[model samples]
Target: MAHKRFAQIPMSKRMRELCKEEDFAFLKSQPDQDQSSEESKLQESQTQKKLERDHRQEERQLNEQERQREIEEQKKVQCHAEKEEKWKSHVAELAVKREAIHAKLHRLREFRDFQKKVLLQDLDPGSTNETINHLLMRL
Candidate 1:
């Protein structure tokens, strides 16, 4: 039982506690164990390197994605601002057109009133000057 417990300790620790003759004997008996331990250490180092490489690759991909997202956001904002500017300009153009149309309508109204007055005077030439003055005043 004590030997089993002793064997459970690591080989390096066991060698430290053992006499030189016993250590030599143990090493001779476990040549394959030492080789297997070296192989395991090599495997662990390779695995650690692979994990670090994968982590760096993942970080690069995340940073690239964030950069793309920022670019896309900038494009969206620029597009929105351009669209807003176009809409504002369109509204301003419409307001200008509306004002021009109102001015033309006012001119047409004045011309219509003048024509009506001329037609009335021609249709009733005998209308008194006082009556014409009263009608013009009412207009």
Candidate 2:
């Protein structure tokens, strides 16, 4: 019912009632508003691009750091393996030397026993076997 009465008013009077100085000023400045909006959108796009670029740079830096860490770890592993190899070789050499020394010691003991029984006459006939031995005579 109110809408019916309001519609009954003349269009010209409605236009005159709705018109205002501020409205015309706003309408006249519409082009500048559009330009400002475009500028703001361009700024936002540039800022977004910069943020994406920074994110990619950070990701690359992280990847580089990870790669460096992996390389360092590999180097450490390689160095450790090399050291282990050296230690194994050293241990093997030591084992060889020990076996050779044991063989030489066994030969020397056999020689000493032979000498005591055959070459040495009766230096101390009552003396028992021991590490230290003396011969009264030689062959």
Candidate 3:
């Protein structure tokens, strides 16, 4: 066993499980079987490494997807909050505008009422020269 030359080579788990002396004697008696065992052990080690790499890659992809989803969710929440704030501000502004319109209408009604009173007074039959002059000016 040239252990110094192959320090990194690991013992095969499958071969370790078949630790009977008879198993090794039989494999040694058959050269093809011994070579096949060596090849299979190397293949198994490579397959294991590949599986680990695939698992790590899959985990990374899943983590990235979750992070993206969280970002999108946060953006949606922020946009919803902004829209609500804008809606509230617009409602407040409309309320102020509506109050201003109502105040103008109230003033106009008061002025119209004053004009009606003045016209009624002028139309009175007991009124004299000033009422006749006012009526002639209206015509």
Full-model lDDT for every candidate: 0.80, 0.76, 0.78
lDDT of 1 by residue, 5-82 (tens): 466666774565565567678767664654777787887899999999999999999999999999999999999999
* lDDT winner, 1 or 2: 1
Which lDDT value does model 2 have at 33?
47
Number of backbone clashes in candidate 2: 0
User: For residue 26, what is the lDDT in candidate 1?
Assistant: 78
The per-prediction CA RMSD against the true structure, in angstroms, equals 10.7, 13.1, 13.1
Clashes of 1: 0
Q: Name model 1 segments beyond 4 Å from true.
A: 1-32, 36-43, 125-139
- In the range 39-108, model 2's lDDT, one tens digit per residue, is 8788789999999999999999999999999999999999999999999999999999999999999998
RMSD of 2: 13.1
In model 2, where do residues sit more than 4 Å from their true spots? 1-36, 120-132, 136-139
Q: Between prediction 2 and prediction 3, which has the larger TM-score? A: 2
The candidate that achieves the highest TM-score relative to the unseen native structure = 2
Q: Residue 127 of model 1: what lDDT?
A: 74
**TM-score list, all predictions:** 0.57, 0.61, 0.53
